[model samples]
Target: MTTEEIEKVTERGPAASAGVTRRLGPATGRPSEASVLNVFSHGILVVWALMVGVPLLWVLWSAFKDSNGILTDPWGLPTVLHWENWSNAWNDANMGQYFVNTAIVVGGSVVGTMVLGSMAAYVLARFTFPGNRFIYYLFVAGMSFPVFMLVIPLFFVLRDFPGSSLLATYHGLILVYIAYSLPFTVFFMTAFFRTLPTSVAEAAMIDGASHTRTFFQVMVPMAKPGLISIGIFNFLGQWNQYLLPMVLNQQEDKYVLTQGLAMIALQQGYENDWGALMAGMMIAMLPVLIVYSIFQRQVQSGLTAGALK
Candidate 1:
């Protein structure tokens, strides 16, 4: 071949290779489309992040501010961080007692719901009994029932007790919370249990494990995600519950954090301490945020895991 022909052929090979590389850019290297999408996606995500984060930032900043700072600059940085605001809120609001009361109601309700809901779900998922569909629908219907509608009846029933009503007692609030939380728990757990492969239950049965044993031993371990999700939901719901606590426990000693904050905010005769009120709100919200951060992945995974199959 001539020297010019050889040069031309060699150049063609590299040019062809470059063309192939362009086509395969997405798989082998970065592409323009991908870069654009990444930038756009991140921009959208940042906007959403700010939407959620700004309010939290405001609350946190308000906590550190004095009353003057709050009035003068609601959106501005605090001139000085009022560390004593936290201590003042804790002591003056009797927040310690509220925390204790909240723990009892939230803790007991979560425990009861998990135990009872799991048992009920296992039975509904595994055994084919009469009225199974009916029972499931009944639980589903409970989800639609208005909580406010039953408050009056619930109060009267509790009041009918011989001595003490469900008024301010922890156990009474727990029972009511359990009943209210049960429908969702049962619904979430049943779906989770149904998604699990039945072969495990069959194998356990072959190995001489009874239904209850199989459920507790084999099934319960697998259902931890669902349990955690349900527990977090119930815990948050009960912990932040205001209406029930306000109505059920009229006494200040039995107030939940939400109600206590209301009292602080509405300091009737005296001027409301906006800074301290904001500080209390931030404190109340911290636990929920912490819990969400801790179990968010599990809760998210569990919530969607059952829906596929």
Candidate 2:
């Protein structure tokens, strides 16, 4: 064989030996193995995306549907947009009032818990104090306990306060929510804070920043992902909380959305208003979904930051 033919044959040896003896047409480029793997991988991801998206889409569609539509075609699109359902839900169910009450409770709880939990986490993560591990474990223990177990004790403790019971009051619910949420928030923030470079704190200290100033101005900003994630979590928990609000807030005006929804449902035993019920649920869910969508990036980043580090 000529030298030129030998060189061409040597270049094709691996492809022929691997049983991949395929010739590309002049116009058609050869597909890489990487491209094939990516196609298969993207196919899996598309399936997963559909699995997650379909349910949310169904819920949104069903919110515009009436009872017969729900029964007959739960997955089908709405015949007519039921925008009035939202208005009715807001008015008839007193969801506007519930929204205000929920705002107060959720806002108060989120602020207090984040502030306290972040501070606690900062101290535990940065300083060498005695029993620090014990304190962290204590908070973790609180996380382990069932929320229901604390309700009875919390009820009496608030009940025995100076003039009136904390039960049925927004402040009481706020306090309870803060307490319940603090443990996990602290845990998350501590892990996140630990992941931060200590040099930032040291540099701030060198510049004559007090611990308080350094924390509020520098460290907290660095920990934004963790705080926002906890805020979203606490908001969802407080928003969806039924048993606590039901047991505590018996007054009509004081009812949070979840408890109000339950009462509406209970009343519907006589006359089931499925459209209204779905509307009420959609109304209750909208804020959480919006908040999640808004801060989803931060939440995901915070969740993975520990492992990433």
Tell me, by lDDT, which candidate is best. 1
Off by over 4 Å in 2: 1-56, 66-76, 300-309
Using all chains and alpha carbons, the TM-scores for the candidates as numbered come to 0.80, 0.76
What lDDT tens digits, residue by residue, belong to model 1 across residues 271-296?
56777777788888888878877777
Model 2 over residues 143-192: C-alpha lDDT tens digits?
A: 78987888788778888878888988978889888888878877888888
What is the Å distance of residue 85 in model 2 from its true position? 1.5
How many backbone clashes does every candidate have?
0, 0
Ten contiguous residues with the weakest lDDT in model 2: 21-30
lDDT against the true structure, each candidate: 0.81, 0.80
Work out how many backbone clashes candidate 2 has: 0
RMSD of each: 10.9, 10.1
